[model samples]
Target chain A: MNPPLLDVRGLTLRYETDAGLVTATSRVSFQVNRSDRYVLLGPSGCGKSTLLKAVGGYLAPAEGQILLKGAPIRKPGPDRMMVFQEFDQLLPWCTVTQNVTFALTASGRLKAAEAEERARHYIAKVGLARFADRFPHTLSGGMKQRVAIARGMAMEPDILLMDEPYAALDALTRRSMQDELLQLWEEIRFTVLFVTHSIPEAIKLGTRILLLTPHPGRVKAEHRSDGTDPAGPDGELLSERIHRELFSDAREEEAGHV
Target chain B: MSDSGTVRLPLPAARTGAAPAQRRRVWRNSPLLRKACILLVLACVWQIYAVQLDKPLLFPTLTDTLQALWSSLASGALFTRIGFTLRTLLMGYAAGILLAGVVTALAVGSRLGNDLLETFTAMFNPLPAIALLPLSLLWFGLGNGSLIFVLVHSVLWPTALSTHAGFRAVSPTLRMVGRNYGLTGLRLVLRILVPAAFPSILTGLKNGWAFAWRTLIAAELVFGVSSGAGGLGWFIYENKNQLEIPSVFAGLLTVILIGLFVENLIFRTIERRTVRRWGMQA
Candidate 1:
């Protein structure tokens, strides 16, 4: 069998805070195959975002290593484009189209005209074609994030690293955005390493979900989905089983639960 | 029982989301009108004081000062001197701003650059520009050179200090975003730090302009003719010596007017276009 698209082994991450060395993750391991909708789901402060950031090449592993294809991950490159949670991630000075084109032109991957053409294509895909010339500040929060995701997708990276891209939106917008993302994924078949705390989102989006334990995050379990239905009768049953494993806190309960 | 006697009241049209109220104010809404009233009051105070003194040599009357101002306007010599003073100030201000840019660029580029900026500003920011006049005269001789030298010193430190502070204030996420796209060195500084910290940088430019203006006037007053001619400062000095007290007052008034015009017109317009539009400042 071909090696997984991304191989992470015995990875550890820590922060040197003013008070002490805070361990965020300890010897966690996982693998992602090509075109896989891999979801890293856990509660807040569970080091899930930190783990994704490590894969994005922003943070280094303290112990084991993350391998992409066959090479070790060292620095951030255009190969792993990121979509951050903040609305201000879009450059305020650049128009929506310019924001995406800049990433292409600045990385020396495409000429100005070509970059602009691709930028418009993605902007259209995200339903922001009319606002192509508007500055980021003029756009709403959801619109700004759309521009950010467009810029990331325009790079056509090996894998898109999304850190809770829809977490900040209102419920109605978030639901619609999630649907849009899934539809876009179906069309492109691009690999995405998605991180979120919502259980239903994992069941709906992930081809496979990796559940992590609280605090210093550790891999608890992994589950596969049918990949054909979200509202199918079987989906409800799987979501409930996954929910139980997460909130049960088996090890914590043994210590009389903090 | 209550349903038999109860009455319902209609809400105000605005409360019920009818036509919005007219966007207008009842107070003195026009800034121009308010400024005119203030000038009129100040003129009255000046007239009263001059009447009490009853002397042109010691304290010229409002009318006598106006007469001096009119004669100068007619001669055109006052305009020439004002122009010269302004030209000198502009040269120094531009140089000072350029140097500050370099200093700030260095500060953000590396640790060593930051240290140099901090060390130099600490050493010289408090040293008055007028104090350097003697040294500048000895070095540059009696021309625009000496005047400009002192003016540059006055403008440089504050500008560099403020710009460095602004660079430090740019958001970390923005910095990471720039870096992730492979931006480093000058491109990163220009595309990211400059716009992010423009509010503080503008504050620096304003401070530098004020400092340069004062330094230019003081240097010219103490040193006499520069580049073979006297500017407004020399005009004030010569008029005072000749006992043309009203003309001296007129020269001082010219200085005040120019300062006011620049602060209100040029700088305020720039502020409106940039930081205010960006919503960085109100």
Candidate 2:
């Protein structure tokens, strides 16, 4: 059998603060196959985003290793493009087209003219072809996120690591953005390792969801959902089951505290 | 509970989402017109005060100063002075900027460079450039060299300080995004740090320009006596010795006009094109 596209073996992550070393995650392990809509779902402070960042090579692993196609992941590279949560992710100086083109050209993956052409293609895919020449500041929060998504897509990286990319949007915009992401996934079949705290979001987006416990996140469980259906063949809600699984840890911790 | 009858009325027809008629912008609201009016009032006050004082030696009337300015322009002496002063100022300013660039690059490159920048700026930034004139003259020997030295001194510290601060203030998210694209070292600095820090850098450049201009004028006032040929400062100084008070006022007016032109026209245009365009500045 072919090795998983991404392998996390006994991964541990920590960062320094004013106080001291803070462990974000410990002994977490997961594998993402090609085209897997892998979602890391957990409560806040669970280090889900940190896990995604570690995969992106922004955060160093304190133990074990992260391997991409059997090769160790090191510093950030063009191979794993990241879509961040903040709207400021897009360079304020560049227009939508230029922002996307910059990702391609700056990575040296494509020349200027070719990058521009591919940039426009992805911009069109994101329904931002009309605003291709407009700057990021002029676009709404949703539109700016769209430009960021286009920039990541334009790179055509080995995998796209997204860290709560739609969490900052309003309810309506968030729903629409989720739909748009699924649509994009349909058209391109791109591999995405998505991080979110919302249970429904996890069920809605991920083909396989990796549940993590709160604080110093550790793998709780991994569940496979029938790709676009939130309902199982047995007529149970996936969100309810996942919610129980996540909160069971919280209840046990509360009992211990009491 | 009893049922109550309610009346419904049709709303009156009104203009709904129609475009407003296009009209010319009001002259009363024009910034240029407002500023010009303020200047005119100030000029009138100066004219009235000078005429009442009737002491041309101390304070020349507005009309007399204008006459001196006109005569100087006609003889081309004033033009020569202005040209000499600008040439010297440009030389010093360019050298200052070059040195500031090097210092800033060094500061951004490493921790030691940052410490050096901080320590050097703290030592020099507060020292008035005019205070360095005597030492500059002794070193460079009574020429444009001395004037240029003081001007560079005035420009360098402020430019380097602001630029270093700007680079330090670039958002970490932006830095990460740049690095994520495989941009490293010089490429990362150019693509991310420089542009992101531009608003601060521009502020630095403006501060440096003002400092250099002030230092050049003050330096020339003293250095002009030692050097045979000099610029507007010399013109003003020579007139003061000969009791040409009106000519001295004319030289002063030329200085103000040049300052205004650079601030309003040159710097404003650069600000509009870059920082304002990028929405980094209001």
Candidate 3:
């Protein structure tokens, strides 16, 4: 196959807390090709979010490396925009349009007029054209997340790093947002490194899903789906197989220990 | 997570009406109206007491004080003194705020800067501005410069301390977002920290203004010694020497009125526009 757009090899990440030297992830290896809806799937405390952060260049790897477009990932840059799970991710002081345009102008990527126009386009795309002038606090939780998504998309970065972006939303909103995101991907085919603990979300969103073990996350298995309708028979089988692989490890470990 | 059933309960009567419907409403909805009523009652009490005492010097009647206030205002003497005081206060307040801005900026930017700000504010914040008047007079020598110096001292520390606290209070998520947007150093401060921390900064400005106002008046009491003209403080002092105590009361009244005007009008308008509009303040 052609070379991947993003590559990770034997990556380990650790952080120093009050408890000292906690290993979050260990020797996690993965590669994401262009236009791949790559999902990092795991249980809670799996360090999938930490892995995504490392890929976003926000965290340094204790060992190994992350390469984006054949580059050694270093510091946070405009090329990798992040969508945090918090509703307060958008600056409250800025209107919706300003929040998106801020990223463009602040990155020195686009001028004022161009950034505003582009932001408007994405705002409209997110069905938030009317709220373009409203503050983040004025918007509902779902609407705020949409604004954040629009802001991330307006930058048109090489990749979007979304860390459980819908995990905070209510059930109905989360379902609709998943569909909205898929539609956006269908249109633009932008590369995304999505971290989530939801199996259905992974099945529904990912072209290739990386299943990770519980703590100090290590890759358990990789599964690929055609990114078609998850309600279809093919998609259902793929999801079942993924569920089996994802859970079988724990069962095997218990059996071995017993 | 399920929405499976409908449940209803009678709402509390207290929640609906607060009290019996037959009871008349005594309190006005507007705080301003309520405060005005309070002011009128206090004035009446003052009038009655002053009349019984039948002495203007010891405690001037409200009307007597108002007459003195009216006369000075009509003669333009009070206005000029106000002008001088405001000019001096503005200069000192602006200079102090600008310096605090720099100090806060430095404090947030690096380790050493933070250490320096912490040390300096801790040492100087408790030192009253009046305590520095003698030093200011000795150094700047009997003019607006001396008054301005003490005013600056009064305004700087609290402003710096509050602003620094504000900066520290900016959420890590916001800071990370700023950094992700390729913002660093001064740009990070201006765009993210300042706006997010503005409520605290505005509080700081308010505190600093009160300090500067008090310091300016007290400094003028002594500053009038050589400058030959002081602000409202000089007016009060001059009136005391002449035993025109009602005029002294008028001067004190003018000071209070001006303070009320600024606190209610200028600062309140600013707070309403920026922090309140942004939902940073209740």
Candidate 4:
């Protein structure tokens, strides 16, 4: 097998506050192979989002390093695009096509016409072809999130970092989004480092789940659900088992931490 | 989870219902009728009071005022005065808006710029632009330069304050999204920051326009010019001195008319096209 696409080691982060230094993450380590849907799961304030940010080069880890494709990660670039939790992630001023074109042009990967064509293609892929000329403000919450996803995917990043991209969506919409995401994953097969607190979401979406303990987060367990096809018949049983195991581990860890 | 334990769902509607024409008519008519009634009541009260006083110097009746207005329009003097005032106002408004943009950019871009803008706005925002007219006259002489100076003073602070507030109100998520698209510098400002802060900027523009209008008229009245190229304010002042009460009332009415045209036609149209359409403001 080929070596992992992303490798992180001994990662630690501390934020400076008026009160004092607050530790957010400690000695977190992980590796994500190409085409791996790696979900980081933990309760709120567990530094899962921080870890994703660090990996995406939005934040610097106080200790250790992250290597992407044998190169050390430094600052944020088009190679790692992020989809934030808020539906407002798509800039309200931009039409759907412009939002995607913005990413393509800014990356300097294509000329204006070519970038527009690619933007149209991705906007279509995300089922937003009709909304290409519409501003984000006019879109429903689910549609806005899809636009954000299209914008991220339009960059064709080495790793897509999602910080609870569907946590804000209503349950029905969230489920539809998950199915769409899985369909997109099947087509594109890009490495993804997704952060979410939901057990079912992790089992349904992630090929590998990295469970972290809350408050100064550290990896508690890693579960591989590679064979579980969430949309298949037997997938429900496997998802339930994964959910049970993850929640139990989370509970035990929380009890131990307290 | 099986369909066997569940009740069958109802069929979806085949067609969506359209809004009733009467409902649309009512929605359109109520606001217009209400405003017209209010204006009629105010005019009746004013006409009654003017007749009771029976002093043309003190107050002119609405019909007399309307007659004066008609005469001014027929002679083209009112149009010329309005054109002059509007020209000065547009120039000052444009300059003030440009300055506010620069100041806001500096404030958002650097610490020192932020401090400078904050201090400058705090110092000047509360000072009336009319009060600055004496100093402006001394510095620039009693010409259009002085009037423009006072107008700029009137417009700049409120525009800057609102713009800065808008910039500060932009959410972190939106900023992150812009960055994710590799947007920075001028592109970032134009695409993300400007639109996100637009509602506030629109408010600032409206306030600044009102201030500049009021300041221009007051300043022009205080320093009435002898040249034929004087504004509505000068027209009002000259008519008042000559005891032409009806013309003075006409000049005042012209000012109100211009203000109404700008507010309802220009600014309202822009608000509807942008912020209201975007649902950022009503």
Candidate 5:
């Protein structure tokens, strides 16, 4: 079998603050194959976002390593494009088209005309052709996320790393965005490493969900979800099953302590 | 269950012809129009007061100052003085900006550079630029050298300080984005940091310009009699010595007009086109 597109093994991430050292994640291991919508599902402080940042090369692993195409990751590169949740991710100075094109040109991936053409094509795919010349501040949060996604997709990176790209959107917008993302995935079948706390979002978008526990996040379980099964064994909903799997450990620990 | 009954009221009457007046109000409130009105009022008061005082030696009338300004302008003497001053100002200002750029670049680059900049700015920023006049005069021995020295002093500290503050304030996300795209060092500073910090940098430049202008005028007024090739400040001093009070007022008027031109025409236009258009500022 061909090697997985991304292989993260025993990756431990730490960051420093005014107080002291913070161990965000410890000895986490995962593999994302080509075209896999791999979701890191966890509650806040689970260090899922930090894991994503480590993959993006923004944070160094305190232990273990992240391998892309069997090569160890060193620093952030165009090969792993990131979509941040903040609307300010788009350069306020650049218009929507320019924002997408900037990534292409800045990475030296494409020439001016070709980059602009590809940027516009991706922008049209994301339904922002009308706002091609509008600044980021002018666009709504959902539209800005679309622009960010288009920028990431336009790069045709080895894997797209999204850190709650739609978590800040309204419920209606988030739903439509999920649908649009699925549609895009259908068209391109690009590999994605998505991080989110929303269970339904995990089921809806991810083909493989990696559940993580909080307080120095460790992988709890990995579930294969086609998002087609509403019910698991014993007539329980899949979301409920996943929820039980997540919190049941905490409940057991509490019972053991009692 | 609520006790209050629902009562419906008739629709309000439609407005009659207030749109034109509101539109006119918008036009009337334009910055240029309002500023012009204030200027007209101030000039009227100036004329009235000067006429009532009836002492041309102490306080000249608005017409007298204008007449003096017109005669000087026509004779082209005022132009020469203005040109000399502006030329000197530009030289010092350009040098100051270049030095500030280097200092700020260093400050952002490393801890040592940051320490150096912080220490130097703290020591010199509060000391008035004019205070350096005597020391500069002692070292450079009069003429435009000392004058330029003082001008650079005025421009450097504030420019460096504000620019450093601006660079420090650039958002981490923006910096990360720049780095994510393979941009590093000078490219990152130019493409990301500079534009992000421009509003503050512009503020610094404005402060530097004001400081440099004031310092130059004061320095020239004191000892700018260098080989009789002095600037507007020298011109004002010479006119005062000769008891040409009207001409002194004219020189002062010329200074005010130039200040207004730089602030309104140059700086305002830049602010409008860049920061305001970018929505970084309102």
Candidate 6:
């Protein structure tokens, strides 16, 4: 409607490895509106993470451009924050509060006192206020992810890029985190580009799902789940249906490639 | 998907106290303490033999050494020599550490710089700092400058090597996380790289200080001209020339005491504050 918040057009990525020039993704395009929860769903080596990296301006595309609020994404900026998959995403040397404050300070967004207050606010929001003085090494995997999420949200980025942020968590923790994330999204309404291979995660979280094909990854399909069901009892059924569809689509894509 | 969703089994709580208790029992029964006791017994035996031999010039008894140490402390000669040695050691150690950091930063920041550091360290690391005494004397003249020059040489390479290795070993994911936050150049290194590589860097600093201490003593012994008057090494050399064996032993004891102070106090405190607290090292 108003020139979507992010516009990625015909994006292609190739990596020069010791083996050969490998095409990671090809002609992949997507658009995300403001406050959209968009998920990129694909199998391993489908270049979903690469696509997320491209959006964050960490990786350059072989072809095509990513525009954020009409400005071409050239390099990484504070405007696009990332929650990495690794538990060590939070710097070990820094306490939770310091980790969040680092972003605010580094970006020159606020003075020390104000930055610290803002950091506390985000840490409290992520339910880690009690652990503010604790370093990352002392945190559990889920707790570390929460710190990462809090740090990202504290930056007040236009878009939050999560690269399979919950992939490292235990099953129960992953479900709890997903629920918490949805609750946080409802409150904040921040735009999110989440990458996950898990179909349940995509269906549960994404307003729109971009299904990608493996190796030289391309957009296989796009599913708008907002109208179907909004993660209730019926939502579980819809998730199952979507899961089957993704597998069949994946199999078909594999057959076509072979 | 089923396998992916399978419940993750929780690992048992790590047995933190058991190992220590077992280690304590073994240590109580082991030859380590017994050997130490035996060594103490041998030292007493040697002291008794020296006293029986009545050889003050050739071999000072333990009591004689203690008396010499006490007299030196009372006269303030021991304190003066210790102060001089500490000043030179600290100056050389600090300079060497700073130079190592600069070199490591340059090495990590660029490919050409990395090549230069590797080549230079390879060329110089093998040459013992003592061997450079003659060249250092020629360059800086016979003074504290020459001693400092050798100390710098001794401290720099080991620190640089360990630091470089630490920098190289930093996890890629951590590096990416730093980059994602738009950190680069000096800020990136100071904030992320240094802290992440702290355990190795601390190890390097400890080794560098030890080397600097040894080099300072050796250099001072060779060039005992009392450049800033005299250090502990020069004191020992002077006492030895005068056949003052007890005073030489006192000077040696002072060196040992200082080494113990630095290792157990300064470096131990640093390790406790950083690596141990961060859970990077035990």
lDDT of 5: 0.91
Q: How far is A79's C-alpha from truth in model 2 (Å)? A: 1.3
- lDDT per residue for candidate 5 within B140-197, as digits (tens), equals 9978899889999899999999999999988888888887787888888898889888
Q: What is the C-alpha RMSD of each candidate to the true structure, in Å?
A: 6.1, 6.5, 7.1, 8.6, 5.2, 9.2
lDDT of 6 by residue, B180-270 (tens): 7788878888888888999899999998988888888888888766545888889999999999999998888788888989988999999
DockQ-best of 4 and 5: 5
Kindly list the per-residue Cα lDDT of model 3 for residues A1-258, writing each as its tens digit.
Answer: 888989999999998889899898999889999999999998887899888888877799999999998989998888999999988788888899999999999999999999999999999999999999987778899999999999899999999999999999999999999999999999999999999998888988899999998767888899886665354455556667667777787788879999
lDDT at B186, model 3 = 77
What is the C-alpha DockQ of each candidate? Answer: 0.39, 0.59, 0.56, 0.42, 0.54, 0.49
Question: TM-score rank, highest first?
Answer: 5, 2, 3, 6, 4, 1
Poorest stretch of ten by lDDT in candidate 6 chain B: B5-14
TM-score of chain B of 6: 0.84
Candidate 1's error at B104, in angstroms?
2.6
Clashes per candidate (backbone, < 3 Å): 0, 0, 0, 0, 0, 0
Writing each residue's lDDT as its tens digit, candidate 5 over A124-218 gives: 99999999999887889999999999999999999999999998999999999999999999999999999999999999999999999887899
Residue B140 of model 1 has an lDDT of: 92
| Chain B TM-score (each prediction, in order) | 0.86, 0.87, 0.88, 0.87, 0.89, 0.84
- Using TM-score as the measure, name the better of candidate 3 and candidate 4: 3
Which numbered prediction scores highest in TM-score against the true structure?
5
lDDT of 2 by residue, A1-258 (tens): 779999999998999999999899999999999999999999998899988888988888999899999999999998999999998888888888989988899889999999999999999999998999998888999999999889998899889999999999999999999999999999999999999998888888899999998778889999996555466678867787788789976898899999
lDDT of each: 0.86, 0.89, 0.88, 0.86, 0.91, 0.87
lDDT of 2 by residue, B50-146 (tens): 9999999999999999999999999999998999899999999999999999999998888899899899999998899889989987898878888
**Candidate with best lDDT:** 5
**Native contacts, share recovered per candidate:** 0.36, 0.64, 0.62, 0.60, 0.48, 0.58
> How would you encode candidate 1's per-residue C-alpha lDDT over B1-282 as one tens digit per residue?
365334333345446544333323423466776788799999999999989988878989878888998899899989889889988889999999999998888887889999999999999998998899999989998888888889888889999999899989888778777767777777888887788888899999999998888888888788668557888899999899999999999999988989989888999999988887655651
Off by over 4 Å in 3: A226-258, B1-27, B138-141
Score residue B265 of candidate 1 by CA lDDT. Answer: 92
Error of 4 at A248 (Å): 6.3
